[model samples]
Target: MRRELPGLGSDPASVRQRIEGMEQILERMFVVPGINKPVGLDVILSLIPGVGTISAAALGSYIAWEARNLGMSKWQVARMAGNIGFDMLLGAIPVIGAIPDFFFRSNTRNLRIVRKHLDKKHPGSRTLDVQATPGA
Candidate 1:
């Protein structure tokens, strides 16, 4: 039997969920101890220098690729690519790179672009936000 991947469906809803999950993993997987700010693989991996930055870029590019598959305009995809490129440049810096990576959040930005496009063109794919009550 073949093992199926999660969120690999070609439907817009599946794509939206997939990209959202990726953005979450790349940009907000954990909270810093004292700072309490969320940080993800993008920031952590970027500390490894060349290979890490490239790996993050590749993962970021996957979002753009999904956008392209959804028939998003070339200009929009280009903008997403530009965001990733700029992020890679920042991550290339020594020591200080992760600091900027912590702030910039290219994957989150790309997710915003993708969400807007999906909301506008594929409204049915939109996911609702549900906040939990403090003591419920």
Candidate 2:
């Protein structure tokens, strides 16, 4: 419905929408169970040599930017970065890395962190106001 954030009008709504879309992309593209054993995009792309893994890392960086925009602290951002770094490092090892990607779901983890921080910054920013009124 209405996605405004205080006085920011539609700007915050646009950002929120983008973040939600990105989260969906991460979840559907990498986290859902599939007929092919549910391997994630990170591992599947890693099979393409240098470019593939790098692309995955780039996507991770985009998530980091969104996290920052969502008011996530530097420490939290660092943790997400470390997770992606670890994914890249471990994903370098042939078949083992790919399998881990299927289970790791780093994108999903980062998405949750971003959503949490955003909600903390702007309560009810993305949901209906169903909580009891203070006077009621």
True-vs-predicted CA distance for residue 18, candidate 2, Å: 2.4
Model 2: CA > 4 A from native = 1-12, 30-40, 127-136
Off by over 4 Å in 1: 1-6, 131-136
Candidate 2 — what's its lDDT?
0.66
Among the numbered candidates, top lDDT falls to 1
Reference-based lDDT, residue 21, model 1:
89
Model 2 lDDT, residue 67, Cα: 71
Model 1 pairs whose backbones collide: none
Local distance difference test, each candidate = 0.92, 0.66
RMSD of each: 2.7, 7.9
Model 1: how far residue 43 lies from native, Å: 0.3
lDDT of 2 by residue, 90-112 (tens): 66666666666656767767767
Please write out the lDDT profile of model 1 over residues 35-54, one tens digit for every residue. 96889999998999799999
